[model samples]
Target: MTRARTLPAASHLEARLGLEMGQYSCAGRKAINEDAIGIRAPDGPLLTTKGVAAVIADGVSSAEAGREASQSCVTGFLSDYFSTPETWTVRHSVQQILTALNRWLYRSGQGLPDARRGFITTMSALVLKSQQAHLFHIGDSRIYLLRDGRLEQLTRDHTVPVGDGHRYLARALGLDIHLEADYRNLALERGDLFLLTTDGVHDVLGAAQLAELLVNAGDDLAATCRTLCDTALRAGSDDNLSCQLLRVSSLPTPEIDDVVGRLTQLRFPPPLAAGNVLDGFRIERELHASPRSQVYLVRDVQSGERFCMKTPSDNFSDDPAYIERFVLESWIGSRINSPYVARVVDPGRPRTCLYYLSEYVDGMTLAQWMREHPRPAVEEALYLVCQIARGLRALHRRETLHQDLKPDNILIDASGQVKIIDFGSCSVASIAEIATPLVRDSALGTASYAAPEYTVGRKPDPRADLFSLAVITYELLTGTAPFEGKLERCRSQRDFLATRYTPSYRINPRVPHWMDGALRKALRFHPERRHGDVSEFAHELQHPNPAYLEYHQRPLMDRKPLLAWQLIAAALAVAELVTLALLVG
Candidate 1:
């Protein structure tokens, strides 16, 4: 593979962060150079998503296909690692690609007449994502870190001493069917330097000498790599020589003020009106508007297709926290693909304003629908709730959480299809790992529909969303909230514990006893007491579970002794009044 001499300069906010890299390889007293190196510094979204990757491989001198093995390992890893799903974490993406590459190399080496002639190589890779350096290693290649003028080895040699000043590789890419690569993460700072070398370079130069040479090299990294290779060859090394140097020039500031300043720099377009055109899209009418954002019904002037364009409100233009959340909402919409979720559209032309587009749906919000229906049947409520659960499952699978789940966030189309919308409050697992100065709290979701744990500052889980779903279901059947406004009044754990759930059957006698039991279990005070998963909750709603039925069958006295005693006293007072009236007659 050909190496790129110059990478594109970082733009906008990313301009504050970049990397410098240098590499060199040569045949040192060997017939052929079997060592290979590769580096990739991507631009745009890839710079933040995949980051930069550098790899070095050393082929076994005794193998006939050693050169091919080393080249393939370096090129394949760099190419495939960038093509992985952006939603995946850095550790997951690299490990999966390495496993597949190892299997292919192992199969190609099988059935060889001599084991020494098989394809084999050692590999070490470094990936810089956000503010962390991820390292993957195998075999005898070495990786080192030079920080604060101190050099330290970060990888262990995968070799075993045999006899008489000779050591054979105990683990390599093609040596066995099962491959175990060492993986670790290190915190990166602005001036940190990383060095990657084959056995040839490290075997010759001691730690103190290598550090002194790197320090003296100053600003010229390419010359430093060339010097390291030449010094190793002159020291009587008999293997292929290779070395790579990478230095962090800067790191992106993740402070809330910085992020907000970058995002809010784009001026919001002047108040749009019908018949106005902007960025190839013609405005038809206004769909919705609020203090946070405005949604407009627009048509692509070229194709005449309708779409919904959403833009941030100027009222919050100076609020950094709100601006950051607005930008993340669009990113989340693009990554998730599901029928039950609204699709985010990419404009064929460059956007002139700070707005995003989505496929327009002629539908009403779930809140509006509930107001019209007032009392939906059990079967109808189950069907709608089940569709919402499916949408939640898609987010959970991608390690995302819809922290703001409520009737207002769901839409029902004319054809009766359900789609979840409004991701401004969602929390993404992979994005959370990135170093940022924003302090995340549990105040994102609405108070009435939000789970009790969130109000008390507990970490949210899938069960929290389930609690919101159960609240919606109960309201759909009985037109009343289960907590009777207690969730909105709660300010602490004590308030949540003091709240009690009113049976759904009491509000609407049409609700079956078993179904009420299912709702009660899903609305438990503690997350652990709720259903294990959304699917489990959906199943219980359709098929009556004996356990839920048994719990519901318990007498009113067992359920609430105080309420039962109050009712008993009222009954006795009425009976005494009747006996006195009979005596007076």
Candidate 2:
């Protein structure tokens, strides 16, 4: 019988994600079955978090351990998919598992007469997440989507055909050192049927037959899959046969979208004043206010502790996109925990308005701190940034990018502990996986601190945060922007690359030449040229990276053109003086 699974939603108004899965395998006329199939959908939140997964693998018959290859891959993928962090997108999670599986298979086959003889299999896997279906495949196993009674093949067979009716797989896991799985995703609709099949079953039964079986399958997907395999066997398939099927009975209504609908009911608190109480929090004073949002220091009436409360501006109270972004800020902040990050505190009380609270830090913003300490020593600046990097790592670990890393967004307490603040412009990868009708704001930050990738309309990664962090560190030590504060004026890639970097040593006498090299590399206009991540950038800040030191050791013109030109001009003046003296003699 087919197993139908439905994820239970916490909110009664939210639609659940549901799936019906079925699988069947048969050796048919073959002496050994080399095909493997699997379907997994955990109950509770996991059903919505990781979604339902199904994989089909057909081991290469020419391989000596074809059965082992097929079986290992099918089981390994199912187990590892759920093991990955919930913050990872389905594609990223599946890709990591596939890479690890491929590496293990390749290494285990070592010393054998032929590596492919020991491990080689064609595989196809599908994940139904949120309102979409993501596909990952290699070799000839096929995944087909039957929607509204029309059948369409979603994957291409990684094979090359020679003469006759024979096609050999050109791409399969364990066949090469590097594995490249083809990936794509599609919007899912209710009542959609997806089919997974190995060559044994698909070769004998064409798309027409598969569509016919699915149409008549009804709700008994198990019987439908078994019939598929049996029909293929009767059609004279001489190899092992396998078939797996999944029907999307329900697609998840994203929590954000559901909340957006509810947002219309919640009221934005009126402008707050000192001693005013709202939702158990007494306003102490307004910390900051802008056209979009306002920040206020509040006292928890029960706990009597102070916190920073952020409330959306009335200007955007009616804007769904703005409301969504505002909600995500609290969601992102509440999840990350680190000493270097401002901790979000749950009020433990029901709310009737739009706002969030974070622990209050008794200190000034890094921007103000920079103004007071003008031209901070390299050591002190690096120490502060290292702490800032720790907070960044916390967000990065959860697949979140703190797009805005300006000095104004960082705070240094009286105790000298640095805390990174602000998550308004962050980009969360896992959340990005969810389909939304509202447009998301670009992950652009303060132009001087934001990476050039955003200005060029390119996607950013952790390196974008590294770039912003580097800008903050550079200004702390040099008391000036690296590119003379021209990054904001750069509208395109060419403009950004053409801008020159002002050396930290030139702006501040305390900065050492080697330390300046680290800053310069981190401040590269191109994200790829910057450090790999926050940790690497933090490490290079304290330790000397010889590669960058040697890179800066090249001719003066390459490192600093202004200084190079000044020396050339001075040398020319001396030569002219010497010529005049000789002529007079």
Candidate 3:
């Protein structure tokens, strides 16, 4: 069998996202080699998204089906881990699989006629996702790391020390009805090496000896593995011998220039006229255009289906950041499957230029709708707010943030369904893990709707979206902003605190006082002061809370002393002006 394999670099941008692996197993003096190892290095999307996985298992020598148990655990974990949902985090997917595998092993052991002769094994697995390594371990098997010319054990040996330097296995698959596996995450650096070994190898070779052998072997991991096992056997290791080696050759950098260069290599499609056709799609009309991108209404020539096509703007042709964002927008839209969010369409045929298609929302933007209905009824405004909140919740659940949430980015279809659009400024948690140089200092959303925390250089959270929603809700109900657009001018926390909210009832008396309180809480300058979640904010809009009512009922003089004093000063000035005019006459 091939004992060594090396995964070449994935991409120029991710040169470090590759691994070299090797394994060697020997029975030594034992009758059979009850040890197994598996490695999976997939290509394309799986390689880019999930990276690589390696597993090593050592079966209990006392068990009758030890070899079968070890082989099954190793093979089962590698196959099942990749089959898990791509949306699941690495820890979640691996843990779920390990739990099921343990249950199966325990049940199989129970069916054995001899209680002591059951299927049992110790396993350790590693998953290299992005720039981090996730490790899962059980029983006495070990995983070690060699970095900066030093070797350190990464897994704890699950054994109880006894007299005369003897130890007993305390944890192993099928040893108990329940299993508790150890998990850890380590940041990966280029040229780092990792070693996985069963007790037969680790117990015989000390850390110094192992590190020396690995360093001497250099890039030949297969030779290193063979040498380690041979040394273990020479040191009187009489059990099944197994060892695996892995090296991180490269990792992906967070720079956007490479991604942008590849995406923009193709020229942007020329400005299309109503009768123009490109790539099987006929342009009906231009929908929108900005410095960042252009959107046009189009129809498939063959199927006659209407769609919206978006292409990067020539104005930003040299701006790598803008180009990267434009491409990511389409990528995000395609992955997210939500009715409340705009849908990205896959153009059946290949395209000659750089552009993407999306479902056409045959309705006006929320900004236009707000212009027509300056002061919508409370119920109508709440309905729209709830729909928008539901859309935001969908993005949040997928570990994505629609950072630029504003009236212009919201589309209200003809059927009155709200769909959030424009993912140019959106942030995806998974993508962020890939290491990028992009700075988060600039606020992604419009100043008027952006959360105060964003202006102060704080990371935007779910509450930030809630804050933007509240601004929209307040405007819908009162034809005016809660803070008279002061939030946009706030440069710091102090400026945000000094900005006072204008009462919704003062602008539109029809707006219930309790509803104003809900909006105020959601739009709080401090994220912590806002609603815990979007659902809570939506609930509060429809339900009247006694606390909000009491607060809203406070006398104007006490509630807003600055406004009260301004009114009093104005009245005195008017009286003085009248007296002076009368005396002069």
Candidate 4:
């Protein structure tokens, strides 16, 4: 009979493989030790299968609510993941944790008593399973892998672009309703060391210095962690400093008998090459490759058919959260059928690697189409736009809102058929959820095309969709958009308001006047004034002279004395003509 590696049968062994890790925070030069870390094992059994590990968070000092939010996020994720079933995979575990955390953070930031409101933070965590190391993170706090005497950063920072010099994070732990974390899985080799730390340590030390310390720090794992913190402090670091280190030997591995089988079966193969066949499909072209996943053009090997395949980013095989989202998008794409929407033929679940098997499309994005063909014929443009309206009508009937309805999200096919894509930002409509105050003002959609109501706390509606379409229509007819100047140079909204269009007849006099008026009505600034439904808007395109109410309330006319005199003169002339006729009789 084979023997299992049970949790230390002896008290010392239990204390050995299952070590309790912790932290020491130093203010360094900051006003507050806003940095934090948390750990919990409510029951010894909770750590029985795979011992629990530590999580650390470093809040940005600039934001007011960073401290509490970061701390809460770490504690909340650990609490939720641990209580869940052991049968759950790492990716699923992290997905639920992030979703729950985002829901809590978004809610916490909205109402009063928001201790960590508006605060952004960088986070890094380590979860040990048998001998494998699982790292979960977002923002800049990093995970470094030490193997064969080399150090590698496991988590990529989500900061904005700089000459490698931008400061703020591009993506954060709790910035939006949807939050995602990057994760990595690595085998624990004996003498292999793992270091997790805030920027305080990395911002000051070079890779060479980090390797030197791990080599000389000897057998004391805690002391090695302390040395890193001390080194950064000595280097005159000016931010909160924190670090956690783990050195492993003969790491535990799951026994075959101990593992539970899942209904879903998912296996990952290394990056694929052109001509490789998967699930009966042959790979054609590679599309996108980010740290989390890769996308490829795949065709049915048997039928010589093609579609898209998306797999986890190289470092995220152990990430349960990413897999969940990948699966969700896959499912959503398959069920939604609209010529304007990207059609999905496959939706992934827990058992399968996430992929999008979509109908292969050949066309230019609206942005590209407009740029290349600056001025398409009016009739042709309207025909193309009407197609978009009809598709949107179908989408509305399904009760779906394309939260991200920007130019890039629209594609124009060879037939001039418009296809809408990228439903990543979509949300189901619900009375209570829509009423939430914070989501109303956070600017969920793209700027420039976004409605003014989005800048304020207003729930999105179908009219929001109209506002975007109007922006597109205005640009298609006119060479420029309503807001044409550089964002930095445009001082106020008033400067960009669509008051007067360059009448298509004026620009291209051959264009009919009726078409211009109808287009103007569709591009109304206020939603109420715009066509109520896409079908109505499309119909108006055919009958450009249809009697329609103005899209927006005309600015109250400023009637002055000069204008009143002209009107009075005209009325007097009409009366004079009537008197002359009576005198002649």
Worst 10 residues of 2 by lDDT: 6-15
- Taking the tens digit of each residue's C-alpha lDDT, what string does model 4 give over 255-355? 32222111024555566899876666778888757665676878776666666676666575554434444544554565466777778774232323435
Candidate 1 whole-model C-alpha lDDT, 0 to 1:
0.84
Where does model 2 exceed 4 Å of error?
A: 3-21, 25-36, 40-51, 58-80, 101-122, 147-152, 156-180, 186-192, 211-219, 237-240, 248-259, 270-287, 296-307, 489-498, 551-574, 577-585
Model 3 misplacement above 4 A: 1-13, 16-18, 25-36, 57-124, 129-140, 156-187, 218-220, 226-241, 250-261, 435-442, 502-518, 539-585
The lDDT for every candidate, in the order shown, is 0.84, 0.86, 0.83, 0.63
Model 4 poorest ten-residue lDDT run: 430-439
- Whole-model lDDT, model 4: 0.63
User: What TM-score does structure 2 among the candidates reach?
Assistant: 0.81
lDDT string for model 2 (1-585, tens) is: 478877665221235777888888989998889999898877665665587899999989998777888899999999999988766789889999999998877777775888667788889999987788999999999999999999999999999998798888898877777998999998999889999999988889988988888888878888898899899988989989888889988777656657567556668889889999999999999999989899999998988999999999999877888887887788778878799989888889888898999999999999999999987777888889999999999989878899999989999999999999988988888777765656667745888788988889888999989988888888889888879899989998899989988888888878877878778888887778888898988888788788767866788898779999999999999999999999999
Supply candidate 1's per-residue lDDT for 305. Answer: 96
Give the per-residue lDDT digits (tens) of candidate 1, residues 359-379: 898999999999999998878
Q: Supply candidate 2's per-residue lDDT for 251.
A: 79
Error of 1 at 75 (Å): 2.4
- Considering TM-score, where higher is better, how would the candidates rank from best to worst? 2, 3, 1, 4
Can you give the TM-score per candidate against the true fold?
Answer: 0.77, 0.81, 0.79, 0.43
Number of the top candidate by lDDT? 2
Q: List the residue pairs that clash in candidate 3.
A: 16-250, 16-251, 17-250, 17-251, 254-435, 254-436
Model 1 lDDT-worst window of ten: 1-10
